[model samples]
Target: MNGTRGTIEIHLKELLEEAGLSKNKFCQRAELQRSQLNGYLNNTITRLDIDVLIRICDTLDCSISDLLEYKPG
Candidate 1:
């Protein structure tokens, strides 16, 4: 699965793990709806809502760069 891909993915799960945050806790702290966050986790997130992203970064005490990563395919 690691090598089977088209576009490279963001390392959001790693960031969440590093922050020691569960999706439930993150949603509460970030003031986001659970379903919306689940959508992101499930890779069904079509739009990146800036406010939600900002809230998540702030709640996690991380920069946007820490929450995101880019890899070339």
Candidate 2:
């Protein structure tokens, strides 16, 4: 079996960290639950919501493109 999942990956945690904001701060500012945000940051989430992404982008002052990227594996 191929040990690869996909080339596309979410860089949410990196973007958030680059914003220089704590997870709690970002969650509060974005009106998002901490648990969900943690899931995203840890890459333990199975799916992502468009609304959440929009909110995160808005709060982080970053575009969706900045939150996602293609990394060949």
Candidate 3:
């Protein structure tokens, strides 16, 4: 197989906006640090934590697919 990999995009910012939630509020509700959330928002997180993903999904009442999208590279 080729070494190509798809990108995993995080739509946290858009989701938060759609939910009418501020970053600070979301961080508080998700029990996440502002910097950590910022990493996800900026797409700079190298690793995806399942617990964090679950927290975000639970807090936003959204499915994993709503928060992330995989695009072929």
Worst 10 residues of 3 by lDDT: 1-10
At residue 23, give the lDDT of candidate 3.
Answer: 90
Cα lDDT, model 2, residue 57: 91
Weakest lDDT window of 10 consecutive positions for candidate 2? 1-10
lDDT of 3 by residue, 26-61 (tens): 999999999999999999998889999999999999
lDDT of 2 by residue, 1-73 (tens): 1127555467888887788999888989999998988877766766668999899899989888888765656
User: What C-alpha lDDT, on a 0 to 100 scale, does residue 11 get in candidate 2?
Assistant: 83
Ranking by TM-score: 3, 2, 1
Please give the distance, in angstroms, between residue 36's alpha carbon in candidate 1 and its true position after superposition. 1.2
Across residues 2-73, which tens digit of lDDT does each residue of candidate 1 receive? 233433344567777888988888888889898887765665675678998788788878888876555545
Residue 16 in model 3: shift from native, Å? 0.3
Reference-based lDDT, each prediction: 0.72, 0.80, 0.91
Give me candidate 1's TM-score against the actual structure. 0.72
In model 1, the worst 10-residue window by lDDT is 1-10
Best by TM-score: 3
Clashes of each: 0, 0, 0
